[model samples]
Target: MYTLAIDLGGTKLSAALIGEKHDITQRRELPTPASASPQSLEYALAELTGHYQGKAHRVAVASTGIIANGVLTALNPDNLGGLNHFPLQACLEKLTGLPCLVLNDAQAAAWAEYCLLSDRFRHVTFITVSTGVGGGSVIAGRLLTGPHHFAGHIGHIQADPHGPICGCGRTGCVEAIASGRAIAAGAKHDLRGKDARAIFARAEQGHLQARQLIARSAEAIAQLSASLKALLDTECIVLGGSIGLAPGYREQVEELLTRLPPAFHLPVYPARYRHDAGLMGAALWCEYCAT
Candidate 1:
């Protein structure tokens, strides 16, 4: 049997069919709707999955935002643009005529990363620094979803009391300082108006301003890591997403982390599945729930 795995992110929407052996095929990608409305998302999903209607036995979704009771609520309205408070599992089931399971993207990714190192560590923390900063944690071998399904919305943690205001209406959230969006938003002068990817390229080309911007993001991420270490004492930290895995980005984070005391130090590694972490994690979680 194959699981139809879908990842709904701030930047893109992707779907793939995964076999029992975990071989992925028929992968497809589409830019997420410019507008984050329920209708927009549903239409996009229909177009993205129409070709695979009956190809899978079930559907598994990993979506950005807070997923509670199968509904998605953007913690930072800026991240997801305040998607409608509708039941996502219900929508997917209606769309595909199959049972569906929905999970927070980072939580799903965390499960996928933990599965890769389950033998080595039982406590793992996964953070993604993409369109927005988000996280998931595995404590003693279990994914912590919390009672309200808001356990891993770590991106909203305050990074600077005086930092930029977040979409969540909070001041100085880590997401406001360390995310790809944040990087792009922080650009000025020669780097102004450039997207995160462009900014990163400029940073690599030795643009002092670009480099400084990314370094600031990395520093915020490092501080977030320190806080996580103190709070959870996680065995390891798994970093993912575009910015997190960009060339030298993880090293930058690690370098900043090294400046701190020993207790704050932990293995900071790129996600094993890379961009596919959320997809694979959703599939694995779907099967795990089935049994």
Candidate 2:
């Protein structure tokens, strides 16, 4: 069986036809519309669904927004143009006549990595430290979905009480200090209009400011990883996303992790499946929901 998976990200909407083996047979992508008005976003998704109408048996979506009781609360209300309390699952299912599963983007990515690694590791934590920090976990082979389906909101965990504000309006959250956005913000003065890629490049070239920014980011992630180790004792932590893939970042994170008390020791590694993890995971969730 095949499933159509849609990943609705902050800046892009990607759709793919994934087979039972987790291979993406076909895909489509478009810039996310400026206004996330229910009507406009729904129309964009519908257009993508129409392209795959009879090609897939089911559909699943991994949305960048928060999902509480199957409703969507876009992270940045201003950029999303205020899409609060929208029944995304119902709307998408109504738009396309097919069974649908809606999952938070991080949850879907975690599930994808879990499906790939659960046979080898019983417990796993999946973290994405990209544009924004987010995480999810599977403990003892079961996905961790809290009462409100917000289990892995590690980004919101307080990292600095006096740090910059987060999109969620929280102060000093991990994301506010260590996310890609945060890294760029901290380096903006020295970056001189450079992007995160440029900042990383400068860091690679030994630029003091860039190097410091990267180290600070790694420290924030290490602190969070230590907390997770203490709480769940996960067998392995899978790091994904753009920043997570950067060279030396994982090593730096490991170095910082070692500074913690010897008791909090768990392996930190890059996700085995990186780029398409979200889409594959959304497809896998469809199978899980079916069962």
Go through the candidates in order and give the C-alpha RMSD of each one to the true structure: 1.8, 1.6
lDDT string for model 1 (52-81, tens) is: 987999999998878988998766555566
TM-score of 1: 0.93
Ten-residue region with minimum lDDT total, candidate 2: 74-83
Q: 1-23 in candidate 2: lDDT tens per residue?
A: 88989888888889999987778
Q: lDDT of all predictions, in order shown?
A: 0.90, 0.84
TM-score of 2: 0.95
Q: Report the lDDT of model 1 for residue 77.
A: 54
Clashes of each: 0, 0
Q: Can you give the lDDT of residue 61 in candidate 2?
A: 88
